[model samples]
Target: MEQQTQDKSTMVVFSGDLDKAMASFIIATGAAAMGKQVTMFFTFWGLNILRKEEYVNVKKTFMDKMFAKMMPQGPEKLGISKMNYGGLGAKMMKYTMKKKNIVTLKELIEMAQDLDVKMVACTMSMDVMGITKEELIDGLDYAGVASYLADADESKINLFI
Candidate 1:
């Protein structure tokens, strides 16, 4: 009989707002970069980031006043480091990223997808949020509770963040 080696880490479930969605991806990206299998289940607003169209429509809260004015609207407006100081924060972020050559959220999402990060959208949330599968990006993993739990149960690092 052949013995199989199990992955050291379990699943990580992320549930929350847009910022939380970005944070979750950062963690998933790190874990995957470290050679650990990562699964990011997006429910509710978190799923917005996964939508191809919404990617360009990602809006910052009132907190991004200046940034909102200078940078593009939606996720495309945010730079790496996920820092938005509220005032010149967006501009400073754009300037810093330009100086340091950092990647954008859109780029991260693309990279994560290419790396097989397992992006799943919540059917329940979709229905409630009035988002249809057609509204989501093509080629993404989409499902309901049974599907999500299938991954959640296999995960040891479950988080509701």
Candidate 2:
């Protein structure tokens, strides 16, 4: 009998909401823990989750600075998808998770990184959003749609968040 290889999971994280970002990272880490190859493709608003809260002091155009100023810097600054009363909802959710002994979104993200999950930033979206590599967390691969598609083609499971 021919041997089958380990499964692969590909996730496209398209939302910047704290809940969705948590879900995506949780799933990616879970799959990685299961010995599956996992890849997370971050595009558009999803890039916000990977952003650094502190400014990187990189030179940019006026539009880039404007975009940086308008968007939330990191996961901690992200608002919830629903019932976000000026960010209060997200704070409440975090408190609830802590009370329940559930992993925080930030911790989950760290776990995903430690588990060696492939994190890919969408270059096209970065260009449009004026996000530079200096603004994102370290150790991420940057690629275009074609690269993501190729990974998806080989993946046994695919999800869009």
Candidate 3:
């Protein structure tokens, strides 16, 4: 019998918004659970979602420290894309999700990791933003646009968020 290849799903996460990040993770995890090969390429502000909440105390340049202090620390600190109301909107959204019994974004990300979904952090974006590997969550690959394009080219499903 001939073996069938699994479908591939590639997602380019470019948004830092809490809601959008949650959506991306939800889709990635769902596809992975369905036995599809999934890759999530995080770029630009999307990288913020993978940042560590606690300070890592890594030696960085003055500018890098400034950038780190200015940006959201992690997924829990991300604001909504619209009507953020100084972060109130994000809190409200989390509360609503909890009330509705929806899986939290953190949980979705954890599930994706557990399912062996590939997580790639865009090197170009990191360089431009002065974000170091130590600031991001562990167990993720670092690559550039060409790498993401390679995966996207083979993917039947692709999304940019």
Candidate 4:
């Protein structure tokens, strides 16, 4: 009889919205808790969720500076995907979550890290978006799409958000 193994999950987080990030972490942590190895590939806007909360002083080109200025700095700065009327909707959603005693995105991120979820920042996307390693949070693997594809190939579940 062929041995059957049930484990491994991979996700491509493509959205920078707070709700989507939260969902990704929630799923990732759940899978990790269930004894599955989880990998999260953060590309494009999703990279914002891994950024540092404080400003990172790094020399950059004019375009890079502009991009850095326009993008959100960290998880707390992300807006909701819908009904975000200039960030008001995000605020309301956050307030409601707090009132309901739901876990915060930051807490979920910490939980994911503690659970040993592999988080990879897309190198190509970082270059295109003018993001530097210093601007991102620590303890992340930096790789390109091929790395994500490899993990996805071995995974039983895959998601793009």
Global Cα lDDT for candidate 3: 0.91
Q: Which is the leading candidate under lDDT?
A: 4
lDDT tens digits, residue span 25-139, model 3: 9899989999988999999999999998888888778998898888898989999999999999999999999999999888888899999999999999999889989889999
Better of 3 and 4 by TM-score: 4
Candidate 2's TM-score reads 0.94
**Model 2 residue 83 distance off true place after TM-score fit, in angstroms:** 0.3
TM-score of each: 0.65, 0.94, 0.94, 0.97
User: Candidate 4, after superposition: displacement of residue 74 in Å?
Assistant: 0.4
Q: What C-alpha lDDT, on a 0 to 100 scale, does residue 32 get in candidate 2?
A: 95
TM-score of 1: 0.65
Question: Mind giving the per-residue lDDT tens digits that candidate 1 earns over 1-161?
Answer: 01111232333333433345456767677766766556776665465565554433443355433432443223543333345555355567656666897765667777777777777777777666655566567667778778767666655566666
Q: After superposition, how far is residue 70 of candidate 2 from its true place, in Å?
A: 1.4
Name the runs in model 4 displaced over 4 angstroms.
Answer: 1-5
Ranking by lDDT: 4, 3, 2, 1
- Candidate 1 lDDT at 40 equals 73
The clash tally of candidate 3 reads: 0
The list of candidate 1 runs beyond 4 A from truth reads: 1-19, 54-74, 77-95
Residues 1-161 of candidate 2: C-alpha lDDT, one tens digit per residue: 01122478899999999999998988899999999889999999999999998879988899988998888889899999999999999999998989999998788888998999999999999999989898999999999999999888888889999
Question: With candidate 3 superimposed using the best TM-score fit, by how many Å does residue 34's alpha carbon deviate from the native?
Answer: 1.2
Each model's lDDT: 0.58, 0.91, 0.91, 0.94
